[model samples]
Target chain A: MHDKTIAEISAGLQGRKFSSVEVTRAFLARISQFNEELNCFITVTEGEAIADARAADERIAHGTAGPLTGIPIGHKDIFCTRSIKTSCGSKMLDNFYSPYDATVVSRLQDSGMVMLGKLNMDEFAMGSSNETSYYGPVRNPWDLTAVPGGSSGGSAAAVAARLVPVSTGTDTGGSIRQPASFCGITGIKPTYGRVSRYGMIAFASSLDQGGPLSRTAEDAAMLLQAMAGFDPRDSTSVDHPVPDYRASLDDGVEGLTIGVPSEFFDQDLDSEIAALLETTIAEYQRQGANVKEVSLPNVGFSVPVYYVVAPAECSSNLSRFDGVRFGHRCEDPDDLLDLYTRSRGEGFGAEVKRRILMGTYALSAGYYDAYYLRAQKVRRLISQDFHNAFEQVDVLVAPTAPSVAFGIGEKTSDPVEMYLSDIFTIAVNLAGIPALSMPVGFVDGKPVGMQLIGNFFSEGRLLNVAHRYQGVTDWHLRCPNGFE
Target chain B: MDLSIEDVKKISALARIEIEQQDIDGYVRDLGGILGLVDQLNSAETDEVTPMAHPMDQVQRLRVDQVTEQDQRELFQSQAPQVEAGLYLVPKVIE
Candidate 1:
């Protein structure tokens, strides 16, 4: 029951093979059995989940169920859930319960999906490894010693472990795809503005996008279908028609041109991963897709550009967490400055503080142009590189990360080394394009992800490409030892 | 662009994050490392490129000016650390 995909579970619910309550209980049982080892969940709303499952059972009985009705899913803790603790994996928001649900959460609930609980993540969605999480690092289910790639580590870990059929994740840089890569699950970050960001905790507002992490592209499509659409509440939400993502999963990729960027295959990439990527491309060629070598000249600047832009935006966005309103506050403050400083210092983790400081420095009067403005201008060149590549191909394919998951605490000491984890995935965010990471193969018994990037508003096509690849490969089907 | 310990302190204060004095040196080293990395952007010739503040080309959507939310001050302030008289209580200014 736990191993079924969203589509399979939806069918089971429709055919009355099992009640939503039974399915939800199965997942809750799994959570109890394995959650301590992985730390994948921050909060398990067992009572609320059972109640929601009972309601879903009623909907299923009434024959008024939607495709996702009665399906169980988890939310990354970053999304606000009214009346539920929505900690963004920080001590600051440890006691914070939102007064309203994020648009993504409400949309999924309206689809009749049962909520399992909130998953853990990096503090304020700041780190590449779950090590920065206040709840403790989420262990990679495949190998408990290895760190699950993060920001959305808990989301990808839970989905990979089959604790849930699908879960929601937000990607500011490579939060969704990198973790999905490390955990051997499928995750997609839709085109920026494709999904509303209102009520979702802000982190680098320009790059953050909420999407789905699941076992397969087909399941991701079903989840994305419900989560994608416009909301007037989000000023940046694109007012575009939502496409039937599930309906387009079977669209063949024959004659589609897949761009292979030469820059992505540079000396910095691990040779073993690069060789695996070639074999993956060969499989695409066999499926009637043509591959061409393309160039993203400014691609080398992506990591640097991202560091400046993301931290600058985060610095401003996170300023709301002063002692006054919601979130943690220090005791016995001597003055307003003391209250602000101590409250924030005690609330935020090391990584979050580092980013806030970097942002503050970049945006300071004397350094603004040399750092912030320069990064933004170079950002356009990076976007133009994608534009040029897309003109020659239907989509771009690259490794999701340089390598598989590393041991916990290995890269945490060096912030730049940790930042390099998103090298292959950040440029997509810079261009506001849609990208998906699907398991392609493994290295040294650990999983590797191949990323597929498409032009703006091309999520359906990206899903189609991933769906066709998933149909031909069984990598996504492999489960970890203990979990299986 | 290497940051000094004083620079780290200034930035931390500007960001309103209190850094312990003992940790200032570590922050200076780490923050300096990050700045050094991002400094590579200085080499890129972006004179002809326009700054992209957002990923998409769309402008912010405008809506009619009307009150869409009902007064929920009590409910909203329920999560505050200190609330009195239906207002959030903070350190007094100009006392």
Candidate 2:
């Protein structure tokens, strides 16, 4: 039962082979055994899980259940779960519990899925490696010593280890795909306005879009069907109709024009991972998909552009934590200025503070044109590059990260090196298009991912290609040692 | 361009995040590297390109004004560190 896909489990649940509570208990039992070892979850809602599962069983018996009615899923700690600590993986919000549910949370609950609690993430969803988490780094289930690629690290790690079949994640510059790459799972970042950001604590508002990380593309489709939709509460959310993602999963990818970006296959790419991508492309070709080499000439500027843009937005977005309405407070204050400064200083971790300062410097009067405005222009060029490529092809393929997961402490010393780790995934965020990362093969006993990028609101097509590719490949099915 | 400790201090004050005396130098080094990386933006000829503030070319969605939400000030204030009567407590500002 633990090895089954979410689709299979849903069928079993509706067929009444077993109750939702029984499945929820089985996952809860797995959490007790593996959570301490992997540090995947921040909070495990044991009493709530059983209670929700019991309610789900009643709904299932009443025949008023949806496909995900009894399904068990966890949300990244960034989303607001009422009465649960919506920490956003930061010490500032460590004491905060949102009074309302994030749009994603309420929507999932409305779908009748049982909540297993919140998963860990990078502090305020800031870092590429999970090491910056206030809860402590989440170990990759594939290999304990390696860092799970982050902000969404724990969400990926938990699903990979089968603690849950699916979990929610956010991607602001590769938070979802990079960790999903490291943990060897399927994850997607819907278009900029696809998911609502109302109660999902803001990191970089323009770039932060929430999606799901699951064991297979099919499960991602099922989850996204529930998670995607316009919310009037989130002003930026697009007023587009939500399409049924599950209905399109089995659509074959024949005659699909796949664009392999020339810039992505650069000198900096790891050789073994490049070779694995070659094999993955061959499988796509075998399925009658055509591949062409396209160029994103301005792609080189993505890292620098993102660093400027994300931090500038972060500095502004994070200003709500001034120690007044919610979040952390200082011990004692000589004045109001002291209260604001000391509270924020003690609340935020080092990387967050660095970005905040960098942003303040960029958005400061003298440097605005040199940094923020200039980055926004270059960001337009990067988006233009994608706009051109997608004109000739239906989707673009690239490596999700430069390489497989790095050792936990390998690149923490140099901030630039850590920023470069997201070189491939950042451009998509800047472009505000949908992208998916699916496991292709293993390199150095760790998994590598092939990223499929689509034009805006093309999540269904991206999932179609991944589901088709996954049908012919076994990489998504293989479990790590000791976990099996 | 490298950021000096004084620059970092001023920026930290502007951002309203207090930096530890010992941590200032590290912020100087890290923020320096970040600035150095973003300096590449200067090389791009963005004079012809328009700055993109949002990913999609959309305006903020505005709706007709109405009373929509129930007052949940008490439930919302439950997590605050210092709430008294119905307001968040902070140190006195005026003499």
Candidate 3:
């Protein structure tokens, strides 16, 4: 049903053949019949997803279910679930809610999955495309006039419109592999403190991560093995050690190697994404990989050192959206600086007030040493050019963008053509590494991806080289055309 | 290098926000065509460059000033706009 996979819908709900309330009522009737032409949900939770699919069909009739118990997913409204409406899509959190949850939604509701809504993004997550969001621009379920790549463009258009088999996004820069390469799907991100950001919301906390947006790569390694581990309320999480991301799924690629960076195929790429990344690096050299080329020339200054370190850490994690606390305030405020300037000028939107005025003019005081200490020393020469190309490639590939899905508001009134569609995903979030994206081709008709990356807590060897290039590509089982 | 509308009204009053006067001539022509491509990172040449904040240059593990949350201050100021006893009310700023 909708081409199964999420370990075949958690082995059809652990073999009873069906039930998690009929797969969460067939994904809430395909998200109420295609989320109003793909605005890709801002809050759907259909009656708390049928009471969390009747409590995951009574925890698989008491066997105490697990491998994502009843599976359904979809989160990206910048985490924080609690009483639901966690609007990080912002009109200053439209109506707020969140009494708690986000430890990646209580570890995907402690692995019984099923939530089924929240999605839409890019406000505090600050743009790449989901047209700055404030709950609008999400479209690209493969070309309903393009433009999905974004602040996890509604979890890559609800896992490329199958509506949700796996979702949850995040990624600060290159907001989850440039909208899972303009909504073809698969996603990832991972590395930086691999997972736990307490309750998400804070955008650039040293480059926010939180992963998975799937269709495959073995369902983003089973939703990044239940949204990763370590969480002592995130002081940058990483206390490490949490493997088994579907450990080596058929680990093929004979001699591996693969790199190919030559400044990620230069001449400012996009010759149809450098000929579909040279035919997916010649199908990873006929599946035995070993490609090579490599070099990161300070990854051509990773988009001006990730726009001066993700807007100086999103202007200090959005000075706690001041309207004296909750979201969007100001009705009749005569003082307190007119209620924090008409509630952040009517709750931000315009690429979150141009990255909160280029992160308060690069942390003010005479432009913090010519733009935030020279974009943090060219972000340590772009992570010492990916620690000198992962000491000669074990993984790395590019074309995650530099063209494809350029229609909707064609470069939303140009913010440097939407920050050069995140120049090959801000040098893998400025080299904290572990990337992923997936789908391989399609140009005018949209989808493109490729990415992969790795190194530094190599997310289970980049999901075993994206599950052996999604086991010889069906372009992650193509879909999109008027939802079949 | 064009921005003036008094530098977009002094960076929209130091980003407290509120900009309109005919939307400042199309936001100073779309922020001077996106800061003329952010002034090509001002003559790229990160001068003997060093600026790479954190992608694991390590040294930031800290975890001892313990508290491990409990006062969910009435479930975090019940989304404050004016919470009472647990504080968070604004509009008097040093009388």
Most accurate candidate by lDDT:
1
What's the lDDT of the predicted structure labeled candidate 3?
Answer: 0.80
Per-residue lDDT of model 3, residues A20-43, tens digit only: 888888878988898898888988
Residues A36-86 of candidate 2: C-alpha lDDT, one tens digit per residue:
999999999999999999999999999999999988998999999999888
Per-model CA lDDT versus the true structure: 0.93, 0.92, 0.80
Give the C-alpha miss distance for residue B89 in model 1, angstroms.
Answer: 1.1
TM-score of every candidate: 0.99, 0.99, 0.38
Residue A407 lDDT (model 1): 98
Query: Candidate 2: which stretches are off by over 4 Å?
Result: none
State the number of backbone clashes in model 3: 9
Task: Point out the higher-scoring one by DockQ: 1 or 2.
Answer: 1
Q: DockQ of each candidate's interface versus the true one?
A: 0.90, 0.88, 0.25
In model 2, what lDDT does residue A361 have?
89
Proportion of native contacts found in each model?
0.95, 0.92, 0.65
lDDT of 1 at A78: 98
Better of 2 and 3 by TM-score: 2
Using DockQ as the measure, name the better of candidate 2 and candidate 3. Answer: 2
**Best model number under DockQ:** 1
Q: Residue A277 of candidate 2: its Cα lDDT?
A: 93
